[model samples]
Target: MSQYKPENPATEEEEPDTLLMQLRRKEGSWLDWAQACQTLLQRQKMTPQVIFEATGFEPIHQNQIVVGSQVYEGMAKAGASPAVLEYFGRKGSDILYELRILSPKDRVQVAELILNRNLNADDAHEIARAVKNYAQLRERPEGFGDHPGDAVAYQAWKTAQQTSDLQERTRAIGRAFQYVHSDGARQQIERLLSTVAASSSGGSQRKILPKLSVFRLEEDLPRLLPVVGSLPLSTAAWEQQITPEPEGPYHLIHSQGQQTWVALPAWSVIQSARDPVAIPIENRLLGTLLNQQIPPEEAQDPVLLVVDRAVRQWQSEGFFLIDRAGSLEVEWREDSGSVSLFGRVLMAVRPPRILDEVVAQDPWQLDE
Candidate 1:
């Protein structure tokens, strides 16, 4: 067999040993070192452990440099200023690593923020997380613009608004003050601070409800419906027939013969539900998509999908429970064409696993 050679063999001047030596001596900027490490791993086929043995660099440090370098390249490509590039070229590997979670445009914006504010790694982490979370919101709250500072301030402001605790609200207000960029955003925080101050004086305090309420499977009881298979009810049956009970909020539905209870919260859409029902997830493909939202072990267990019969119109990309031929199934609005919407899916509820039953199945743990 002919001798195997690398597709792009390195010249004597650009050999693997030369790269290793440069890394060992710390001969160039941190960016250059990062690139050299990447070249060794990808082109030279050297493992991080082998490189660590050759040079004093640890594996974790290697990972940081490689990833941070990519983030730096993204910043540069996004037209980051020369000062910003120069500042990061020599140091701030940890800060850059935290920025890898951001998009290219966001990376440049945040890098400039870091440079301008003289922020540390921890601050960089907070800024990146805030920006990412803001980006994922379906609609931005009024008065908060799209700037990096605005994103941070918005998060702080939101926290302040939602929290009823005195200390937590104070901390959130402080953070909002620190990050508020625009005058409008500043005014918003000021109003929130004023509320806190007024509340301290024993004025009529506005109570903010907690955003999430925890419901226990064994403790709480709601309306119950025993269901079989994935189809809960036909579109006509829900729209023409189902009505709320006079006793209380009608929400929970049980899967017949299975330890599952599908519950719907008193959301505005759900409260308006004429007759909502719980459908057990039996389709494999549908179950796979829904599995992304739940724990992996629960993938095989039945997922109770709460359907709101009140919502029949296609508003967005929400998953709708529809009637396909005689069979009821879950389908995304984007993929389906002109089908009658049985109900829009309010949420998917996965029942908590019975760990005691699992422990009983282990033969080694059985008592004599």
Candidate 2:
């Protein structure tokens, strides 16, 4: 056996930390370096206003700002602000990037919270883990970031926040119910109803009561009657009869004589502008036919037959393609905008060249 030699990897052509150190020592310009840090923060969706506030870099010089690769690394290494550094760290690493649900405000809030040492990095992550919904539920309330509160309480409160006006009202009903356990339950309930009543006008009162009825608080129904008029009976009894039907492979609507209406399973449509495979065969055929790849008469039938067979097989086996690794195009919805969605359930087997081309091009585009 050969004697083992420890591997010593060569340094990268551009080491961001080294370059930042060099700039710091030689240039002696904190503003220039601060601007660099600002650019990096902006890329991570940190607002320019926040960065300027965090680091008091005077915006006096017009030509002071210049673009460079190492701004992020420089900013991160310099410890400009703990919040900024944590944001940089969360974004820079692959592990923390999964918190895509957290909006820019949520991120800034977390950064600010971190600055105050009210929230640890782990607590910040818990906030980010909540799924982004139609309701801007991730947004912190006015006084939330001001104090470092329990992570669980903050998460619950954020969840309770709804974006839609009607949903917000509905949520308030739920909160009023929850507040019953707390010390100031009666005050909270009165405040909630008062706010709803203040917002309600003559005609809109009809609409508001009906929507509020959607979220049933059986215990509070007696108290709510005077405010909301009369409560409708909860639909729980009838909902069982209309339990959701299963989605089968196919559905038949008509079976009479010649005329019939049958629906196939809704196949996912992928918008793959960059995929060569997605290019229409008719468009490609002209060039191929001109090059004499195939006779014009025979080209269409063989291609159509191959596609038909492949589709049939794919549907039958629940796989568009299969190999030693796993199946492809089986369970994935091509319409999904998520990049990590594929990696979540299965390993996507793609051609090495295609992967290389994807990696080499604009990196952000892949996420899209």
Provide TM-scores for the models. Answer: 0.57, 0.21
lDDT at residue 363 of model 2 (Cα atoms): 73
Candidate 2: where are CA atoms >4 Å away? 1-34, 37-109, 115-118, 129-368
Top-TM-score candidate index:
1
Q: Candidate 2 lDDT, tens digit per residue, 184-278? A: 43444445555556555532332332235355333211110001111121223112211112233321122223421212222222111111011
> How close to the true structure is residue 233 of candidate 1, measured as C-alpha lDDT?
48
lDDT of 1 by residue, 55-168 (tens): 888889989987887888778778999999889977998999999999999999999999999999999999999999999999978788889999999999998888898999
Worst 10 residues of 1 by lDDT: 1-10
Error of 1 at 289 (Å): 50
Model 1: residue 161 alpha-carbon error in angstroms: 1.5
Q: What is the C-alpha local distance difference test score of each model? A: 0.75, 0.33
TM-score of candidate 1 relative to the true fold = 0.57
